[model samples]
Target: MDDQHTPADTPESEERSALRRVAGLSTDLTDVAEVEYRKLRLERVVLVGVWTSGTAEEAESSLAELAALAETAGAEVRDGVVQRRRKPDPATYIGSGKAEELRELVVAAEADTVVCDGELSPSQLVHLEDVVGVKVVDRTALILDIFAQHAKTREGKAQVALAQMRYMLPRLRGWGQSMSRQMGGGGGGGMATRGPGETKIETDRRQINQRMAKLRREIAELATGREVKREERRRRQVLSVALAGYTNAGKSSLLNQLTGAGVLVWNALFATLDTTVRRAETPSGRTYTVADTVGFVRHLPHHLVEAFRSTIDEVADAHLVLHVVDGTHPDPAAQLDAVRKVLREVGAGGVTEVVVVNKADAADPAVVARLLDEEPGSIAVSARTGQGIDELRALVDRLLPHPEVEVEAMVPYTEGGLVARAHQEGGVLAEEHTAQGTRLTARVSPELASALRAYPDYEGSAST
Candidate 1:
């Protein structure tokens, strides 16, 4: 071979030229590069919203919340678009032209999903999906997905599953052969084989209904157990306070700070799904049980509210509700309204609520001051730094309903347990040791007052 063409004796310039020729041949052999197709690891989503009411700022804030919700659901939000409309388009929610624009944006962003900021009707959802050419989910479904992801406890899982099923039952669509009816077959065949059986959609609907029914029964049984526990607490005359708030508003953190519950706290939406009750003592040594329940969101799905009613009932049955708000949230007022709306829906409207501005350590002082002014009597505190906790405890102590009965009881040393019960159940105003046994003056529950009657020299008054 020639020196330039030989394997070991080729010149450097000739070798480079030969390598380039080979590369060109390889490129020519395949006009298109062999792109490896990988399944999308994360759902890429584009958000669309209609500004039906409220200012542009409010509309943008709502869209921002939807984006946060999408992120919480493990979706990468690629873009967000808001349309100014007097009302949502009955057919497409964002109207046909805006829906087309959204489709273009979604395609340009390589998004696989479109999330609407507001809940859409069935027709609207179908039409939007047809226009966007991808999976289209509304705000309700997005929140439900987040809930389904975060539910850990059995009851929590049941509630979330039930909500999802209910949401899905309406959105169930028939696609080609999946919607076909099964043909019934008989042992003898003939006309029996031609008999029509249930369609796949009907079967799915029936199965979902049956599952929802089962979940409801399970939830009812769980609710009964919770009610029994509540009854026991009532019998002991222990005041119950519930920590209620918007998702990720620091309720669990506050619960941990106040009661050392050690609840799992994360900086994500709907991090804690199950209700957690922890015993906390006030500054005056009065004991109360604080329950941290599921957080609320704006336009929370009605199915979820119904399914989680058993858990949320903790808030309704509470003697006081600490409405925790994220002080650093852009629209704390909107969050407050959202919470209040759910409270009303769950029959917790009449419950006494104390606004708690949480995340004070991270919030702007001016924002905190404004919240305090807007919420009158609202306390600003940071669960992380323990700021203003003492004041919050004192305020809780003051707000808890007090026993009206004041009593003086003299009992033998053998009944020391009853005396201790008096201290546990109500405020002990006075105590003294006497020759007979022990003299005591304490405000107690009616039941405790009745129980103290078993002792001698028991005098009761209706004044605290």
Candidate 2:
């Protein structure tokens, strides 16, 4: 009955219906049998999206990216469709006609899964499954699945679980046989396909709520420990710089260049899920810590931001932010916006940012030139080549907090600590060891320079 030359009750359609019927639990299985029934692999998927305003090219690219995400999560994308509309249809995402077309396409393609390009409400998901006669997932769930795959650290795993639980909270079913067991079905009679959740959807909801609370409490305890470490760094007066950029940008690469810290460098998105901090001394001998945190992507999930807030605080508290960019990405400007938007959302908007255009070796000179034109004063460097590193060091030196006053200082024998402090903390230009103490010519902070004047045995003059 559809334009695709497919009948409404074709053999393929009937097969799909059969699959879903078996996917649901039957009323004649034992608990052990029911457990076996729950573990089914999702079938091949077909993607559907609506392009409202953008050009066809953009819509196609978005759909392609969705397909890649699906494949990453173990779903094979068999076919895709994009329809133009004023906006997404509220009821079915695509209109009824398109939904029918999708069902026929799913049958013809033998696709067992349907994934929408945008976030779908619970009602939308249910309706799509009904129309397409297969399991349905939206963009949000697909993203969550990917996060679940990439999460490696304990905190990362916990955060992913929290996000997934929150996402599933609203979609909990109410009247299913799965809920009936919780209502005290003893299962002594003809309970063929009986399973644990036959009566307790409410209990399941309550348990999930309890687990969500426990997860938050655990995360909070971990955050307190993280805060303690941050405070220790603050007390040491070590300047903090955070590396922030779009996912797949060369942030980890640059971090290794700066401090010789061998953080994992990968070509995949979200490669660095945990925050790593390393110590580095600036050209002026000022010690600072640089942190590499997770990268940002466009339309990043709001729950992810909330869950990762403790980790994101690295950027929020940093004295300076290194905004790395991939000079080779075709849309570097849009990538920059994505990074900045996430920073702003995380309350790191006002941090002083230094644009670092990395991976210059692979980037076209024209692309690099255009980037500099757009973001004047950005550092252009290739971590592999060690190019422009000295210039970068000089820039960090100039940006960091410097002494207000410059002076020459001489100290007593007992003030060796102050002498060493002058050389390490202060930017000592010249120094000599003497019987009295280390006589030094340095550009030091006024406080330390003033301390030197208090010693009569020390002979030093503050610069006018």
Candidate 3:
């Protein structure tokens, strides 16, 4: 009976029974500078948030999302707390009082880091860490860490590194020698400590700038290659579609379902960073290219947006944009707004957009119905179960822009390649084979129309 009454078995402590067990992310860096700007082992984290305005539920939801981000970074979440206040305290974010309370929670839970729900100023981060006596990471830093971990391609890695450099430029913290106030003269730590302290900071800043310039140059060079490929697609007159959405909203899953691209799909945030482009054919035999790009989150850092501008251009340059939203999320509308905000920033606001509410199988039926009603022309689909996929395919086919030029021509059996080109690059309105040649009527690009006119051996053809 007494054993049952112990602190570990108390109702208040039951929630700490390890729900998830994964290898903890190791935060060991080569130097203190690396520690400041490089990886952090957020192996165990305590989430803290300041509730300024929104209702209790909204605040809780925000914190819940933060918890998810931490877990994605390989952290074990032990506890989370929200403090009610007019606004985040200037010095410590959650106020010094709350920071102390958070310290208690961290110590009790044996957490090594405290993750805040909102981005913190450098001073706030330092002050809060001083009070809490543990590493403090804000929302922006946490998201950046996740991106750093998940980025796949060379360009993606460079972009993430540039963003990390941008983020750390203003918030660089120093240790021991770097923090020394050594001066050659008078009272300021005389001979022993009279070394290059401020010089160290300047040196670090210079190195960072040099590295950032190199990364920008490399990224620009890479962007050129991507643009050339896009131009090639355009030269062929293939319609392009880009998938944009909230992270974990099943965009990759839908892409796989649509084109069988077999792109890796994970249930983690920012799982897909590099843009993947694949060619797909509509049921009506119309061919269009589709790209599955990186996902967005609420309050995504501007540094990231600036760094990933070239990648985001995939959406801006696309002929159609599929904005995917997770149907099962508590606030589907919020996710929609967040993604739309990023799209607008990327100059994709003028592009044709189709809302795709995904994960319908796991989402509440009533919620799905309500969301579909709110979103006129939106399609609800379950990529896992293949529900509404046919309707979605048909809808996409109907919405895709059709070639304006219509032509009818007869080609020799030897020119079978042109006949195939008509079928692949344009919409085949009518086709008939006669002994003379195969007569074809199709709505195709001007380039294809010109090719038909150039052939002298082919029979009479007309374009309208």
Better of 2 and 3 by TM-score: 3
Tell me which of candidates 2 and 3 scores higher on lDDT. 3
For residues 1-464, write the lDDT of model 1, one tens digit per residue: 73346543456633322201001100111212321121224578887787777786787788778888887776777777777666788999977866787788878878899888888889999998999899999999999988988898889999999999988998888888778988665635586576687888888899999999999899889889999999999878899999999999999999998999999988988988999999998887788999999999888999899999999999999999999999999889999999999999889999988999999999999999999998888999999999999999999999998888877888678889878877666888888777777778789898888877666464433333
Stretches of candidate 1 above 4 Å error? Answer: 1-40, 185-195, 434-436, 457-464
Better of 1 and 2 by TM-score: 1
49-135 in candidate 2: lDDT tens per residue?
877776766666667667656765656567787776777778888867678878998898788888888888888888878898999
| lDDT per residue (tens digit) for residues 1-464 in model 3 | 44557864676544432111122222333466744453555478888887778786777788888888987887768788877667788999976656777788889878899989888999999999999999999999999999999898999999999999999988987887776654544546766756544456766888999999999999999999999998998888778889999999999999999899999988888888999999888888778888998999999999999999999999999988888999999998989999999889988899988898899999999999998898888889999999999998898888988878888777778999888888877889888888878787788889998886554334443233
lDDT of each: 0.84, 0.77, 0.84
Q: Estimate each model's TM-score.
A: 0.87, 0.80, 0.86
- lDDT minimum window of 10 residues, candidate 3: 17-26
